[model samples]
Target: MTPTVIPIDTPGLGDRTYLAHDGAVALVVDPQRDFDRVLAAADEAGVRITHVFETHIHNDYVTGGLALAEAVGAQYLVNADDPVAFERTPVRDGDVVPVGDHMRVRVVHTPGHTHTHLSFALSADGEPVAVFTGGSLLFGSTGRPDLLGPDHTDALVHAQWHSAQRLAQELPDTTEVFPTHGFGSFCSATQSEASASTIGDEKRSNPALTQDEEAYVAELLAGLEEFPAYYAQMGPANSAGPGAPDLSDPELADPAELRRRIDAGEWVVDLRTRSAFAAGHLAGSVNFGIDGQFITYLGWILPYDATVTLLGETPEQVAQAQRDMVRIGMDPAAMATGKPEEWADGAPLGSFPVTDFAGLAQELRENPDAERVVLDVRRPAEFDSGHIAGAVNVPVHAVLAHLESIPHQQLWVHCAGGYRASVVASILAARGHDVVAIDDSYDESAGAAGLELV
Candidate 1:
């Protein structure tokens, strides 16, 4: 059987890596820091990974291609234009790498997501099958052009329109499309959960394909949102050659050491549920709520490069949380597992004020002109769809930058759900603002809580 392309998802990053083989040989594309799944899958199929290819110098996670290729003795490949410390089999557009007796990999120079982006054409039995279009093209939306920094955004977006047009016009309608970023990833220009699409499907449905180039660029540029603060560090790590994947248990900290770190103002991240954390946590610790969309805010809400301590409910949980943090290039100094009451001993545990949707409604009704600022931390597009009549639309990542403009009076915070509200509440509270977190459902609160949606 011709080995079909298998998409391996990294849930924390909301990205997918692919594996394709022709029974005897395989190719790995855009792997994350963890390569266990890729390696194991190749082994199970009894195929050696002949080539490991990167779609770009990724700005989302530290890729594991170099190490994975070394382990399997496979040729690692990257675009010729991508500057990196280590050596790789540099490839350019139209270059084809033979995989087996019947399969060949064609390189397409698709530059949009980055200056040196390339998409792989996977062929079997001398027939075109699929393209691994990484960040260049996604399910519904294309990759955001601003990932390289503000300077490259304008030029990249213009290039993105051309790159997208190339794919639509050149590739056959039946060719399957696989991409690296989508499904809650900040890398995508718009919100979509579509798993995969075909050249025909995209050409007929994608706005970037149907709309004029100028209109596509305008819509694409306007839809970009604030990404994580740690994003700035990703490309550098990938360029310098990241250290070996070490998601192993960080040195376990006893209660005393954990307490000392918290007292020292180190970023002690509580990786429990929001309710568990809000009930009682260490005085100086912050709640990140590992179970819900945790990784997206990990680098944004916490201090970049600060010594971090992970407090999970168990050692296994701590290990998982550590993996999520390191995949995005955030390293923790130490980690521990237990409740704050257990670690705090006699010290007073801290709790934040939690208001339900109804409680916020009552507060607004009573205050009349109190003008309680409902700070919506969701993306601008999400806010534009429907939000509280007077809720301010500053996203979570831009909250710190917009602090000077917000009032010092009573501030109410809510996201699409309660997860982000908890994060924003902690951040605002840390900055000496009177913040109340609405911990209830956003959709439920729309009209039930006397909220007038605009």
Candidate 2:
């Protein structure tokens, strides 16, 4: 009988954890810091978790491997060469561990995402079932080689190429490919739309398998862009063995406390929808709407060690954001749940104009000399592909650092969609800059609105 594999997706983080079981016993892979989800999964599956595995010391989110293992008394497996501070059952290349009666795992040393990375190939009795390629071999891409830094990038890219080839050559073509990253993850060298794939599918579509090593490395390096700044802290936190998250309600803040924190240069983030925030919000509050990829962009642009106070329409929204934050090793300093009017305590709420690309085109046509600046907040590559003529390009992730360079005139901000544009616009508005957020789809709205794209 084949072991059943259940994917536990953290879509906001663009990662997945696996709960694979042979009916009676189970093993977990690459769990997030909030390990309660894994425990819930185990309970639903009706299996005792007997083992936990780590593919590498992650660079994106704090790992819950040690904590989860200890909670269930499961043997934790990590690479023997990881140099971690915690105790674990360290296994090496070519080592095979039996899991229950029907499943067995063969460890393959597949380095590249990190020096000590390992991929586990699972078999049911004697038949290959699946391979957990944490960050090594993805669906149509590979894990980025530069996360370890520039000094190791060159050698690591080469290693990544070979590691991908090794997996292709060793695993059966029918083996299901279960990767931890690549669904909108910055860890992927490039993104893949395919949610599931087999070794044969990757061998045909993946650059590492189709192109020469030289070509693959050059393309991969050229395409790399800035990842979240918060990534610098994840590996160390995981290495030290992260504890469970503190999901208890944060201390409630009153209107005056919110004002004080804002005046003190702390981040007062609004978690309402972008439109709701634009309609009315506390002055000096930035919008990272809960409806969008809230955690990813917030983690990217947030200044390290800055105190954060979350403002939401309800307590549940704030609670969900808190869970997302702890996965990236952050805890909110305080929280408030109410409308901006309620939080303002009779003070006037601040707001700005929200329009679509068509409205922007009309404004430009109607008042060509209005002293407005159209800002493209998409990534550099997206800007290069196509953008409004004369628009300034500043990727949303780097907007804070490039604030000095942004034109002081009235600004119209946009991204592929509107989420990032709202982020940049709200940041500028909080800083007292004249801003307008283009809440429209760039591809559909730009051309339909008769805007000139260069």
Best by lDDT: 2
Off by over 4 Å in 2: none
TM-score of each: 0.92, 0.97
Candidate 2 has its poorest 10 consecutive residues by lDDT at: 235-244
Please give, for residues 1-454, the per-residue lDDT of candidate 2 as tens digits.
9889999999889999999998899999999989999999999989999999999999999998999999999999999898889899999999999999889999999988998899999999899989999999998999999998999899899999999999999999999999999988899999999989999999999999999999999999999988889999888888888877889999999999999999999999999999988899999999999888999999999986779999999999999999999899899999999889888899989899999999999999999999989999998888999899999999999999999888799999999999999999999999889999999999988989999989
Candidate 1 lDDT over residue span 396-450, tens digit each: 8787688789788778989877999898777667556777888888887757888
